[model samples]
Target: MEKKLERIINNYLYEDIKEIQKSENLRNLGLDSMSSIELLISIETEFDIQIPDSYLVPGTFENFEKLKETIESILLP
Candidate 1:
């Protein structure tokens, strides 16, 4: 799942996961409103899970690690 997430981020945002800081902000990664929406859609499609509005807030998508954690929480028991 982590690898898939990284690939989606890399493909959509055009940043290499190996080069990205875990704490780097998504906005700093060049994510605008459009890309952010596309990223959310990609996440749901990749993981085959529906993300609730509660997880769509700014803090949840703050960085790569946070986004991974958010999806992890949703997918894992």
Candidate 2:
């Protein structure tokens, strides 16, 4: 899950992903409408879970790790 999350972020949104100290702001990583949509789709397909529209917004992600955790939490039935 961690690798998948990292791939989604690095492949779709982040070109400057770091081993440490990456930015917390999605906006800083060029999170426009298209990227957000791709994120939503990739997460849903990869996790086999539907993310509510309310949870897909920038405010919900907080940071890359936080986003990964949220997805994993949803996966843990």
Candidate 3:
């Protein structure tokens, strides 16, 4: 599941970037509000996890990894 999420993010982010570890800045990699929303939706579809609206705040790719973690905890729990 982690690999899947990493793959999805890597598809959009540059390859040079390290795998997301809950601390990387996705925004610097070119993520935006719409992209974030789209990514969020993709995660839900792929993992069947319902992400909270709170995780979507302040739209930034940098926040993406954390969002993934948040969703993962919910789905895996």
Candidate 4:
């Protein structure tokens, strides 16, 4: 799941996956509002899960770990 998430995020980033720190802000890594939306769509499609409206916020996409946690919560719940 982590690898898949990284691959999806890599699609929108200029940096290599290895260079991205878990604590780094995705927005600073090149994810803008539009890309964030697209990223959400990609994640939903890939995971076969529809993220609730409540999860659609800046904080959800604030970093890789948070995004992973959000998806895992929905997927495992």
**How close is every model to the real structure, measured as TM-score?**
0.90, 0.75, 0.70, 0.95
- State the local distance difference test value for candidate 3: 0.66
Clashes of each: 0, 0, 4, 0
Model 3 CA deviation exceeding 4 Å by range? 16-22, 59-65
TM-score of 4: 0.95
Per-residue lDDT value at 8 in model 2: 77
Q: Candidate 1 — worst ten consecutive residues by lDDT sum?
A: 11-20
Looking at model 2, report the run of 10 residues with the lowest lDDT sum.
14-23
Q: Is candidate 1 or candidate 2 better by TM-score?
A: 1
Name the top lDDT candidate.
Answer: 4
lDDT of each: 0.84, 0.70, 0.66, 0.90
On lDDT, the stronger of 1 and 2 is 1
Residue-level lDDT tens digits of model 2 in 1-77: 77777777776555555553444676567667777778778888987899876676666555677787778778884
Q: Write the per-residue lDDT of candidate 4 for residues 1-77, one digit (tens) a residue.
A: 99999999899877866686887898888899999989999999999999999999899999989999999999999
How much is the lDDT of residue 19 in candidate 4?
A: 84
lDDT of 4 at 47: 94
Where model 2 places Cα greater than 4 Å from the true spot, the runs are: 19-23
Best by the TM-score measure? 4
- For residues 1-77, write the lDDT of model 1, one tens digit per residue: 87888889886565786697878888887888788889999999989999999878888778889999899898995
lDDT value for model 2? 0.70
How displaced is residue 59 in candidate 2, in Å?
A: 1.5
Which of candidates 1 and 4 is the stronger one according to TM-score?
4
